[model samples]
Structures are given as C-alpha cells and as structure tokens.
Target: MDLQTLTYIIVGLTFVLYIGIAIWSKAGSTKEFYVAGGGVHPVVNGMATAADWMSAASFISLAGIVSFVGYDGSVYLMGWTGGYVLLALCMAPYLRKFGKFTVPDFIGDRYYSQAARTVAVVCAIFICFTYIAGQMRGVGVVFSRFLEVDVETGVFIGMFVVFFYAVLGGMKGITYTQVAQYCVMIFAFMVPAVFISIMMTGHIFPQLGFGSQLIDAAGNSSGVYLLDKLDGLSTELGFNQYTSGVKSTIDVFAITAALMVGTAGLPHVIVRFFTVPKVKDARSSAGWALVFIAIMYTTIPALAAFSRVNMIETINGPEQTGVAYDTAPEWIKNWQKTGLITWDDKNDDGKMFYANDARNEMKIDRDIMVLATPEIADLPAWVIALVAAGGMAAALSTSAGLLLVISTSVSHDLLKKNLMPNISDKKELMFARLAAAIGIIIAGWFGINPPGFVAAVVALAFGLAACSLFPAIIMGIFSKTMNKEGAIAGMVSGLTFTVAYIAYFKFINPEMNNADHWLFGISPEGIGIIGMLVNFGVAILVCKVTTKIPNDVVLMVEAIRFPKGAGDAQDH
Candidate 1:
C-alpha cells in the first residue's frame, strides 16, 4: 500500500482502539472519573503511567533535539528520567498514602486551609496548560505530516479525539487507553531503531549499535566507532564535536535539577499513583513505569546518533560537499510538504548543503529529525506509517492525561472541594466533563499557536511545576510544622519569581536571552532551580515565625506518614 493509505489506516485503527477503550472504561461516578475507582493493579497502572509520562516530548522530540544539539541535549534525558525516579522513590508512595483525589486536594487538606488548596489548583491548572500545549502541538505536527492537513486543522482533530475520550472516560477511560498507547508507542519506537541499527552497524539493538563501528552495504566494518565518526563529521560541518557539550556546568545542573523536581511535582503523573489501591502498589507501579519509561529513554541517544548520521550522509553525500538538489532523496520532498524542511540554492549551484554557519542552504527545523529519519534510511511504507501512529498515540495519551488534571483541578479541587461543598457526585462528574471539554479546546488553540518547540515548551512547564508545587508538597509531607501561611507564601513567591524571569527572558526580550544577561549564568530554562530554592527558603522562614501547628493537624500528618497499625494498615 502507498505510505499515505497505510498511514491513514494505521492511525485510524489506533484512534478506534483508543475510543473503544474509553467507551468501555467510562467512569460511572466521581471517584471513577477522578481516580479510576482506585483499584488498578500496579503493573497496569505502571503501563498507564508510562504512557502518561512519555508525551510527544519524549517519543517524538527528545531524539530530534538530541540529534541537533549533540551532547548538550543529554540534560533532557537525565532530567526527565531522574525526575521520575525521584518522584517514585521520594514522593509517590507518600502521596498515595495521603490518598487525596488530586494534588490540590492533598495540599488543601494537609495545610488545613482551603486557601492552600486553591493556590495549588491554580498552579496545577497553569502547569498542565503549559504542558498540554506541547502535546497538542505534537498532535498537530503528526497530523499535518502524515494526514496531509493544515497544522491548525490537525490540532482541531486531535482536540476532538482527546475531548471524546477524556470527557467521557475521565481518569478511568484515560488509564485504560494509555495502556494501549504504551504498547503502540514502544513497538513503534523499537521497530525503527532495530531496523536502522541493523542497517547501519549490523547490530540488532540500537543501544549497542550506537557505540559499534559502522558497516557498509557489503557488511564490512569501517573500523571507526559511530560516535567517533559522528564527532569528526560534526566538526567538519562547522558544528561542535558531537561528543562535546557547550553548556556551562552550572546551567546544566540547574536545568537538570529543575526538570527532576518538576517531574515529581507534575500533577498529571502524580494522579496516576492515586489510581492504584495501596501505597505499596503506588511504589510498585512507579518502578514498573520506570522500567517502561527507560525502554524509550535508553534508546533515545542511540536513535539520535543513528538519525543524525543518516541525515548528514543523505544531505552531504559521500564527498561531503552537497547533493544535487534534483537528486535529493524522496524524504526531503516528503518533509518539505509539511514545510518543516526547506532548501534555497543561494550560490545557484543547484546543490543543497547543510552546515552550522550562516552559509547553510537549507532551513531544517530540528523537530523534523525523528519523523524524517525513517524516510532518510529508506524504511518501508508500513514502518513509516507505524511511526506516525506511534507519534499520534504518544501525543494523544499525554494530552488526555493533562486535560484530566485540568478538569480535576476545576471540578474537584476548585468547585467541589472549595467553592461548592454541597455539590452532588453526579453534578460534579458533569462539571468535570465540561471542564475537560473546555480545556481541550483551549489546549488545541495553544497547539495551533505553540509558544515554542515541543520539548522546549515542555521544559518551561517543568520549570513552572518545579518552582510552584514541589517545595510545598515536600514540606507538607516531611515537615509536620508546615502551615497554610508558609506553604501559600512559598508557592506564590516561587511561582512569581520563575514566571517573571521566564517572561522577561523568553517573551519580553528574546534578544537578551544569553548567558551574559542571565542571572548567575543561569538560563530561563534553569531558573526554576533558583525559584525552588527561594520557595524552600521562604516557606521555612515563615514556618519558623508562624504559630505552632494544630495538634489535630499534626496528628493527621503523623498518620499520613506512619499508618496506625501493622495488619490494620494493610487492611486499610
């Protein structure tokens, strides 16, 4: 079958599968809508959590960014993966033990103040909105390319799909759908990696092939390590060595820290733990989710290398000058259809040359690397179609997760928990569905008019989460003295500081977004670390001066940390 037909068929089937799962697993009550009835098996919830964690940022854009930025992009790999481990080991079980419906609910009740909950709700909505923007954009990118629609049109289509499942099934629907998505995503990613690994290095595993010496079409070793050759080729093209990083050490640390803390604080991922029945199950599912997540994370660097090498070899040809424009591979024209890759023959040599300097003849968006990789390597139409389906799966799954968070924040946290304490469960469910529908529409708009690239936009959301929520949650559970006044003050200050810094550097003045203008040489992406510190410092300081915690609230904190009995605890 033609690539387009295969793509449509495969993508259509996955959508059908997702919708069917959503319909079958539809929530019947407020509890099911919010937490999937709180009876999910650890392994099942783990798979669902993995799908929720690995958005378009992971499956579609991480490799693409790594391919372009080389060693510097390792921060993303380390940050996101490390963050998940942190959440699982340090927070997930405790949050599960707290047994709140949402992050805001946990904060509100833990601090013994509705104000604390409202602040958390606002922050959750803000962070999830920013995060969902990237997923929506990812959906649009896939649709625009594989389905041959306008980017805006693609986003609207994604909005509808996500809206249908998210509004209908709520957490119950999203959880089961995510299990199917995880299977599709991992399969789609690994197949191409294995294919290219064998094609390039005579190895079955891309992870091994990344370091293995290259093999020619005759299956003879070229005697040069893959990374070594990539490094040499990179410098030849006027780019930094592929194995060398250029980001300052401090900035790298800050960005990684921000991402790590932010991942733990992400409301969507945290909610997955609530779906499981027991605290131990939360911990178990977290490990399972990590295993599933690592499958993709480990393959990213290898795929980045393989895709980069293939793209360069195709564009620059054997002689390394350029390829004749007319003779360029079919992949070039295919990507050009999406307007993601373009060429201009400046010198009129009728050849397209890619370089690191201003003389570069092509305008290639980094976001296209992964999608274009299979085509560049001459992978079959079915394999390419599978990737499109996988990308869509990744994008839609995460968007649904984020939309659920937004809805829960509004319907459960803002309304039922605080504003309308007397609301009926049925009415609350209706409001949750309404909130999800509206959230998707807004998210679709952001996707159509995204603020940045998929990964970059997501990084900012991570920063926001890091600054606004991680500190409060940490203190809430660990420090019995944590009060509403301190937590509220910390969240407001930290969030404000991070937003101001990001807005000033990223939006207000993009020209000065350099190390020279940055505070302590920290980029806006890494500023969240500073904001987090500020939050911690301010909250601790306020607690020291505030009135002592209530004995009742103190007792509650003790129980959340250490459940009353041994056998009774398990039964509870």
Candidate 2:
C-alpha cells in the first residue's frame, strides 16, 4: 500500500478503537468520570499513567532533539525519567491515601481552606492548558505529514477525535485509551530504533549500538568509538561536542531538579494516583510506570546517537569518497519537499560536504528525523503509517488526560464544590463534558497556530508546575507547620515568578531569543531551576513569619502521612 493509504488506515483504526472503548466504558456517575470508579487495576493504571505522563514531547520530539543536539540532550532523558522516582517515593502513596479527586482537594483539606483549593485549581488549569497546547501541535504535525492535510485541518480533525472520546469517556474512557496509546507509541518507537541499530552496528539494541564501533571503508572494523566520531562531527558543523557540556553544570543540575519536582506536581499525573484502590498500590503503580517510561528513556540516547551518525554520514562523506548531491536518495527528495532537509551544492561542485561554510550550510529540521526515519531507512510504508498513528496516539492520549483534569476542576472542584453545592451528579457530569469540549476547541486552535517548539513549551509548563504546585504539595505532605497562608503565598509567588521570567526571556528580550537566554548564565530551558528555588525560599519565609497552623489542618496532614491501617480509604 502507499504511505498515504497506510497512514489513513492506521489512524482510522486507532480512532475507531478509542471511540469503541469510550462507548463501552461510558462514565455514568461522577466517580466513574473523575477517577474511573476507583477500580482500575494497578498494572493497568500504571500503563495508563505512563501514557498520560509521556506526552507528545516525549514520543514525537525527544529523540529528534537528541538526534541533532547529541549528548547535551541527556538532561531531558535524565530529568524527565528521574522525576518519577520522586513521585513514587515521596508523593504518590500519600496522595492516594488522601483519597481525593484532584490535587487541589489534597491542598484544600490539608490547609483547611477553600482558598488553597482555588489557588491549586488555577495552577492546575495553567499547567494543563500550557501542556495540552503542545500535544495538540504534535497531533497537527502528524496529521499534516502522514494524512497530507493542511496543518489547520489536521488540528481540527485531531480536536474532534479528542472531543469525541474525552467527552464521552471522561477519565474512564481516557484511561483505557491511554493503555492502547502506550502500546502503539512504544511499539512505533522501538521498531524504528531496532531497525536503525541493526543497520548501523549489527546490534538490535539501540543502547548497545550507540557505544559500538563504526565500520569504515573496506569493511575494516576501526577502533574509533561512536561518541568520539560524533564529537568530531558535531564540532565540524559549528556545534558543541556530543559528550561535552554545552550548558553550565549548575544550569543542568537546576533544570533536572525542576523537571523532577514538576513531574511530581502535574495535576493529571497526580490524579492518576486517585484511580488506584490502595495507597500502596499507588506507589507500586508509580514504579511500574517508571519502568515502562524507562524502556523508552534509556533507548532514546541510543536512537539519538545512531540517527546523528547516520545524518552526518548521509550529508557528509568520508574524506576519500563523496557522493554527488544530485545522486541523493529518494528519501532525501521526500524530506526536502517538506522543507525539513535542504542542501546547496557548495563550491559549485554538486557535492554536499560537512564543512563550516556559511553560504553553503545545509539546513535540516530536527523534527523530521524521527518522523521520516522509516522512509530514510527504506522501511515499508506500513512502518511509516505506524509512526503517524503512534504520534497521534501520543498526542491524543495526553490531550485527553489534560482535558479531563481541566473539566473536572471546573465542574467538580469549582462549580459543584463552590458555586452550586446542591448540584446533581448528573448535572456535574454534563458540565464536565462541556468543559472538556470547550478546552479541546481552544487547545486545537493553539495547535494549528503553535507559538513555539514542543519541548520548549513543555519545559515552560514544567517550570510553572515546579514553581507553583510542587513546593506546596511537598510541604503539605512533609512539613506539619506549613499553613494555608504559606501554601497560598508560595503558589502565587512561584507561579508568577516562573511565568514572568519565561515571558520576559522568551518574548520581551531582544538578544535572548531562545538560543541566547541566560539568567546568572542559565538558559531559558534551565531557568525553571531558578524559579523553583525562589518558590521554596518564599514559601519558607512566609511560613516562618506566620508560624500558626490550624489544629485541624495539622491533624489532616498527620493522617495523610500515617495511613498504616487505613484499608483502602473510600474516594470522597
């Protein structure tokens, strides 16, 4: 079959599967809509959590970024995966014991204040919307490339699909759909990596292939290592060495810390813990989710290395033998039409060389490397179609998760809890569905007109989460003295500082366009670290100044932490 036909088939099949699941598991009650009726098995919930946590940024963009940026991109691999350790160890079980529908519920009850809950709802909404926008963009990109539609039309199509399942299924529907999405995305990711690894290093495992020796001309196995070759090639192209530090050590450390904390604080991820029946199950589920995520996280570096080497080899030749630009393969032509990879015949010799010539520089869009891999490697059209379906799965799964969180916050936390305390469960469910539909429409608009790169936007979302929600949750769980005043102050301070810093550097600054952003010499990607520090500092200071904690709030905190005999606390 042709690539287009195969893509349509794969995408259509996945959509049908998701809609079918939604119809089968249509949520009838508020509990069912909010937390899948608290009946999801731990392992099944773990897979669903993995799908929810691993967003479009992870599935569609991480490897592509690493392929171009090389080892310096290890921060993403380490930071993103490492955060789950914190979630499992420190947050998940305790929150599960709290038996709350949302992160704000934990904060509200622990702090003994509706104000705290409102603040949390604001933070959750901000984080989810910012994060969802990127996923929508990922969906649009996949549709445009594989389905051959305009980006706007692709986004609208993606929005409708999400609206259908998310509105019908709620968390119950989204959880099962995410399980399917995880399978599709992981399979798509691993298949390409396995193929590329075997082609390059005679190893099926990409991690092993990344460190293996390169085969030289005459089939002589050289002692030159993959990393060493990559380092040399990178510098030749006016880029940093693959293994060396392009970012300051402090910046790297801070960014990693912020991402870890942010991952723990994200509302959609935290809410997944509520679905598990037991507190211990939540902790175990986190570990299982981490293992699933690590399967991809560990392999990404290898994919990056192999793709880098392949890209360099294809664009630049060994010093002795060079292929003419006119002789470039069919895959090159296909990608070039997408304007993702373009070359000019430098020196007018009709041969593209890997040299630092400003006028003759070859431009390659990093996003294309992963999406175009099957074509580049001469794999069958079905594999390419699988990739397209996988990308959609990744994006749609995450969007559904985020939309659920947003809708529930509005209908359950804000409207039902605060405004209409007498509202019926059926009315609440209807409002939740309405909120989800509206959120999907807004998110779809942003996807069609994306403001920035997928990774950058995700990082900013992490920064917001890190600054606002993380500190409050950590202190609420760990510190007995943290008051409502302290929690509210911390969230507002952290969120404002982080968002303002990002806006300043990303939009307001003249010279600090993404490439040049630095505060105390840290890039914007790493600035979340600074924002997190300020949040913690301000929270502590405010707490010290107002050292009074309510007696009831103190008791609530104690209960959440010491749930030894609490036999599967009922979800409120």
Which candidate number has the best TM-score?
A: 1
Q: Which ten residues in a row have the lowest lDDT in candidate 1?
A: 563-572
Overall local distance difference test of candidate 1: 0.89
Q: Write the per-residue lDDT of candidate 2 for residues 1-572, one digit (tens) a residue.
A: 78899888888999999889999999998888999988888899999999999888888788887877766677777888878788888988888877878887778778877898899898899889989998888787787777878778888998988998899989999999899999998998889889877776777888888888866545556787788888887777677778877766877787778788888788999889888778778877887898898888888888778777776677666551345878866767766665667777656777766544463457777777778777776777888889888888988999999999999999988887678878888999999999998999889878877875555667788998888888889998999998888888888887888778777776677356544446676766667777777878888888898869978777878888885532342434
TM-score on alpha carbons, each prediction:
0.97, 0.94
Q: Where is the poorest 10-residue window by lDDT in model 2?
A: 563-572
After best superposition, candidate 2 residue 3: deviation in angstroms?
1.6
**lDDT (C-alpha) at residue 318 in model 1:** 71
lDDT of 1 by residue, 1-572 (tens): 89999999999999999999989998999889999988889999999999999988889888988999999999989999999999998888888887778898888888888899899998999889988888888888898898888899999989989998999999999999999999999999999999999999999989899989999879999898999999998998899999999999999999999989999899999989988878788888999998999999999999999999889989988778899989989889878988889898899999889988866898888888777778988999999999999999999999999999999899988888778989888998999999998998899888888865444456568888999899998888888898888899999999999989988888789899999999999999899999999999899888889988789888878877863221111100
- The residue ranges of model 1 lying beyond 4 angstroms of the native Cα positions read 452-457, 563-572
Candidate 2 ranges beyond 4 A from true positions? 215-222, 317-325, 342-360, 452-456, 512-517, 565-572
RMSD of each: 2.1, 2.4
